[model samples]
Target: MNRNKKNISILGSTGSVGTQTLEVARSYPEAFNVVCLGANKNTQILEDQILEFQPQAISCDYHKELSTRGEIPEKLMSLSEIATYNGVDTVVVATSGNVALIPTFEAIKKGKNIAIANKETIIMAGEQLTSLAESNSVNLMPIDSEPSAIWQCLRGENNHISKLIITASGGPFRNTPVGYLPNVTPANALQHPTWKMGPKISVDSATMMNKAFEVIEARWLFDVPWENIEVIVHPESIIHSMVEFSDGSTKAQLSYPDMMVPIKHALFFPDRAPKSNTTPFDPNKTKSLTFESLDQDKYPCFEIALKIAKRGGTWPSALSGADEA
Candidate 1:
């Protein structure tokens, strides 16, 4: 009940980003309070988080059955309920696919600050969502590393951005010949070179489709035109992203490619907390930072995705749904 602590509700408490968000909260117990949690059906991990965090309420498919066991919280809320709950201050939309879209819209409507990691939702309805957030005076903080990097770089600046340079690790098949890509296995695609992520995202990274989604996200998040946003293959992900201003000067955010850094930033915006378990980025240790132009032929999925993004409307929704399927 500390007045200084942020009351948080994580929509995907059992997923990759969700668990890391909890880790950040656990590290800074004085700064955050887990008030609510929502997950699909990962009961075992959800139960463990429930016992550890002891949130005031939770949303899960098995809530009714868990309630009968007597250890569950008194209030079992749905994802929308959790987003608009009076006791919650910020909602973390970490759930994948389109599942978190409605709940995120509800949170914005209720004027709750959102820390969203889901890309599909933004790709689908970024314009509407950003407009609603502006009208409601709510903050839609980005939890993804690229967007977070851009967000950090624009912290104290005026609206004079010239271009947004989103960085990508180029995934596991960066060096693989274009002809060999068709025969790559799922296991091969999942072996991302830099960061560990969920299976779907890993595969998306291999095809550079994740970067394409990010490009669409940046267009809406920063109000930049598609022509102004560019993606580069940075094999070493030491530099998260960069923003070039109209005055010819550029600002970039750098880290060791850790998700916790961005999550912590979103949780405690307008202020920075002390470092957690992530190692500090040392320039002396890194040999050389390299960048390459993204080859459209090598990543046809990325090109096709951007085409679909430009078309707009329900096309993005359908594309994301098809990708999920």
Candidate 2:
């Protein structure tokens, strides 16, 4: 193991964000070392990732299947345990849903810099986690594209931010009539235009609930008030997010819609590496950019998430559970 390389443990190595984090790690082999990996119930994918990254510690919800792999610890650790494992210097919280909160908190408590892909973790316990990270003197980095965009826009701005404008793709049902919401089947909701994502998130996108969660996430990640955070439907997803300063000027982060861009940004903070697989924004290709306000009636989940965010405490936990169910 290279002494200088960042020793990382991924909490959700089998998921979309986890795989992309690995891709970023794969692109810069000398910069990062995979010290640990965890997965939920995807034993097959977990097994495959183990053969590749070869982490010293492993955690899977299914302990029996993981025991078959001699490389993984026979006494498999839980997500929270692997998160604060001694060898890991950075912990990437990529697990979806409320399950990520505990491990993310545990990692922060241990003073491990965190790259968080799971928005639910922030939505549920952003205040507590941010406070924990501050006390522990560790970084809690956002991996979601919108929050990352807000983060990028706020760079060196001297905390003069007046408002954070988060962008939304408006999802597949953007054009569907409000009267037809009840008719929306799972398959209908899953047809996302710009990004390929998992089913639950796909549904959330269709409902604009994903954007709402981001609103709460931005609130905690940037320590901005609820009124200071806003969302607009930008069907193209070219502009990830925007920030307005007290000086009355707004700056937005634009890139070709790619998760790897933000992933790389969080992994290597305050410094940018050359793009490996991500495409740079081309003005010639992007002729027009449009933004619109979200209709409250069409997307009730957005309102629900915001309501939960404002309520604070364990309300977000309930919101996450309701969304998952």
Candidate 3:
């Protein structure tokens, strides 16, 4: 590793995005370093990743494993400690659900730059979270695809953006008959048509619940109105997302369906570093791009998400937690 590379701490170190993040850090030896890693129950994958990255610190929900092993590097109690480690510079909140909120808030309070991948934290507590970040002048780089696309285009311009049109791949049920939804088995729901993801997210996608969650996240993340938050079904998944400006112009961010691109970019904002496993995108050779308004009638989950964002306070938190139970 380069002596001058920025130190990074990745929460959720064994999951899909977290694994890709390690691959990016490995690929860019000169630009970044993994100083900390945290996981819940997947200690085996976590064990393998730790042996490779050799992060300065690590954490997991289980402490018995750490007790049994004596050769491991820095191990800590909390995400908050990982975020504010002495030599660590960038904090990546890759953990699932609202569990990331407090630790991410701890990072911001200490003035650490954050590369946020977790959406539940922002979806439920966005108003409070954004206000806290602003109060401290923290640079909250987005690791999610839609927000990153908007941020990339919104840079270096005073031009007003009128609408934030977040695209959805419409998941496995995008085409399953309307009445077929209630009968949608978890087995069918888990099969995402395009992206490879963990079980919770995969299930969320099929029910259109992830897009619903995104609606709320966008509301506070961009400081936009709930009504202005829009979703389009682009089953091809080529057009990751788009933005519409007040001057009648639209900017779109297109890439092949890969989570690593946004993950790497968020960690290395203001500078694009090299990474592996992402398919190179080519617009000319690409097949086709399609878009359509979200069918609220077919997908009531999306509508409930929008309504929760508009209503404000506790409801969004309740729904997300209910999913966990």
- Per-candidate TM-scores read 0.97, 0.95, 0.94
Candidate 2 residue 166 Cα shift, in angstroms, is: 0.5
Q: Judged by lDDT against the true structure, how good is candidate 2?
A: 0.86
Q: Output the better candidate (1/2) by lDDT.
A: 1
* Candidate 1 lDDT score at position 138: 94
lDDT per model vs. reference: 0.91, 0.86, 0.80
lDDT of 2 by residue, 273-296 (tens): 755667789999887999989888
Best by TM-score: 1
lDDT of 1 by residue, 1-325 (tens): 5568999999999999999999999999989999999998788888888889998889997764453333688888889999898867899999998999999999999989999999988988999999999999999899999999999999988488899999998889889998887898999999999999989999999988899999999999989999999999899998999999999999999899899999999999868876668887999999999999988889999989999989988998888887888
Give the per-residue lDDT digits (tens) of candidate 3, residues 26-139: 788788888889898888888888778887888888745654344577466587788887777788888998778889989888888888889888877888888888899887
lDDT of 3 at 12: 88
User: How many steric overlaps are in each model, in order?
Assistant: 0, 0, 0
Task: Give me the runs in candidate 3 sitting further than 4 Å from their true place.
Answer: 1-3, 66-70, 274-277
For model 3, give the 10-residue run with minimal summed lDDT. Answer: 62-71
Best-fitting candidate, measured by lDDT?
Answer: 1
